[model samples]
Target: MSCYNHSNPSSFLLMGIPRLEATHFWIAFPFCAMYIVALLGNFTLLFVIMTEPKLHHHTSLDLLIYYFLCMLAGIDLVLTTSTMPKILRIFWFHSHEIVFKCCVVQMFFIRSLSAMESGVLLAMAFDLYVSICKPLRYTTILTNAIIAKIGLAVFMWGIGLMTPLTCTVSRLLFCGPRVISHSYCEHMAVVKLACGDITLNYVYGIMAANFVVGSDSIFIAISYILILRAVLSLSSRDEGLKSFSTCGSHVCVILVFYTPVLFSSYMQHWGQNIPTRIHILLADLYLLVPPMLNPIIYSMKTKQIRGQVLRPFYQKTEVRINFY
Candidate 1:
């Protein structure tokens, strides 16, 4: 029996934004700024949801939506954190070396968190569908217990789907030239370095992407279709428009989250002539852009959240007005 040789390669050098080594310092600033915005926006949204009593006891449906939002915020944080810090280090300090085990761990977290974010978006879609279509039974249909169960299932689904991929990659023997061509340890990027056959890894990766992301997107589309149908059936045109508008923010978020992802996936397989720098930029945007924009989209579109966000400013304004 031939034992697997895990000691042949111990680390990997991440090539950040290929061919742009002379300007890594210039690139790091924007990336760092995006990271700060994502962190502050997500944390502020979470704080408003948790601390504001007005936000807490609004409606049963609102509460349910809040739960999903919390889950999403947490997932976005995990997803970005898994890659951005290491990416910053790579670009800023020229610290490109990452231990193999650490690389595997980062890849696992990034994939799993992205999958979980998809699940959370699906859950949010269901929430929107119920609130719009089955308004009468929204609370009964999605009770606290059911919401808890859904969150648990989404979490487990992500972990379960990514476990096999992580395990498979961990077992592979990596030879020399252990350099990853992207800013982070992406699954396929890491797998490409393996000395052994990667057929199983590729097969499993395709299956997982189809099963998790594809299925979630299909369900979200169906939910939105049903929601639109229900909204259009309303007697008052204005009311119908209002109901449809509620989903505008979610639709924007969905577009922002999935557009780059789909593009990146296509580029990965078919965009052979695409520049490596462009591919790496797309990959970074896939992780960073959604987290940075989701909170802003919601705050601007959702009156409830926006109200909470501006309450202090409004109060101070009123105080000044009264003093005058």
Candidate 2:
């Protein structure tokens, strides 16, 4: 796909954390902190899951956790890489111009990552339902082989679904006033600058959101309904409690991930009065905060994971201190 041949602007300004005076140290501080935290948190989760024998237990629930963690790592990279470089440019030179190619790449990668997140969440909901509703067949349904197959399918679907939409966007002509209204080259922000007709792109964008966001959310809701029905049928209180607790964390995470997506999608499609600042803030939180929060939330409630993963790190640090 080729960017529309239009006169390039001198530079683009990022309106980040509004009203704060842009100072080198002040601006770089938050970006650096968020990037490091996202990296360390997702890395720890992935490392523990890969290395710990306890986490290697062959269970339907464990497979779901591992799937979500892998998705979260991808998200962490996508979120930080998409915008942090721009933040650094602002700190160093007060502003920067994104080459046409760089802008298209940013837009594609960001949307693709967010769309892929919805896929992962839907897969997780299916995993939960199978574990609860069909316990007898879960071993057969969610084996290592099946989990690997599902993961590959979800990623492939993410790629197939996003490629064309982003390609369409790349063809649009971007003219003067390249100053993006927000920190990143969001799909809509870049497309809006196009001097040419974006009607087809808009149509495809809505369709993508409907299939990726709407369909995933509906499936998740249905999966939970089935899970709830199965839990209610259980006569034992202990069994019901365990099921509820296990699903509660996942439900919370799903809400965090999807609510903002639907909010932005709705405003774009239906024409809402939501302010740009509010929309941008929510979008950033949706992309950035979730990656940091998921690993923390999972580690807190999952006792086996906590003990097997976090405890070993602490024990190792203590051993080093004693030797010193």
Candidate 3:
């Protein structure tokens, strides 16, 4: 009860990796490398996409794809940026304490941005479905105005899904030990430190996980199925290959993004018998892996992006953008 009357906000200690404290120095190197790669990859993708005339204005389909790629690259950048530095600090400097309020803020950004990323992937799936399965109506259905609304909806979808959870967490009485058993201010880890009944937190977290992940996974699967059917119906083998090539990057991104996420989320909730170190490792890897790989996946799969990447090596690459 007296904890509720404390003058200062609670400061929680972050354990970078539970059992690998001695190897923090060595571990920091690879994690740091991944962060650097993610930064360069995502930023280069953004710059090249923004400056590439073909991707920007070749066709309405190309334009819409560019817009989504921008959104995806931007999201990956923010998601990694929000949590990785602090994690590195924890690993290298042993800077582990985070204020309760700061923890809440971190929690908000990680949770919301993750959900937003999922929404964007779902949007991408829809875009692919329309492009492949309903090619003629694609232009009519996905104008710039419609794209803007989709972006807004993706942003709001994240907020709507996470706001309640964040608010509930903020209002909880965290009167117990402030030692969080993970690298960052992960929501369940923080919630585990709270004093009172956290049944609502548990239930809401499970439900939200189901609603966001389950539904999006289903829709994405359905979209891909429709896309596959449409592609297979094509009499030309080359056309089917091209269609698969178009979706290959997206499928890879989806797997990279969602596989670890689903594993970590459910394992954290249900895999109590599982070692804490495994969860911590996955959490750290999951944050960095998708961001680092997404751009590389796209670059390898998309010819235009690959050209822009190699362009500077061959010639003085010049890219221009206009502000109106």
Q: Pick the candidate with the highest lDDT.
A: 3
Total clashes, candidate 1?
A: 0
Predicted structure with the largest TM-score when compared to the true one: 1
Candidate 3 residue-wise lDDT, 262-282, digit = tens: 999999999999999989999
Residues 156-239, candidate 1, lDDT per residue (tens digit)?
999998988888888887875888999999888888888889999988987887787789999999999998889878999998
RMSD of 1: 2.1
What are the lDDT figures for the candidates, one per model? 0.88, 0.74, 0.89
List TM-score per model, in order.
0.95, 0.86, 0.94
Stretch of 10 with least lDDT, candidate 2: 1-10
Per-residue lDDT of model 2, residues 189-264, tens digit only: 7777778898988888888888888889999999999999999999999999999998887887887777777886
lDDT of 3 at 208: 89
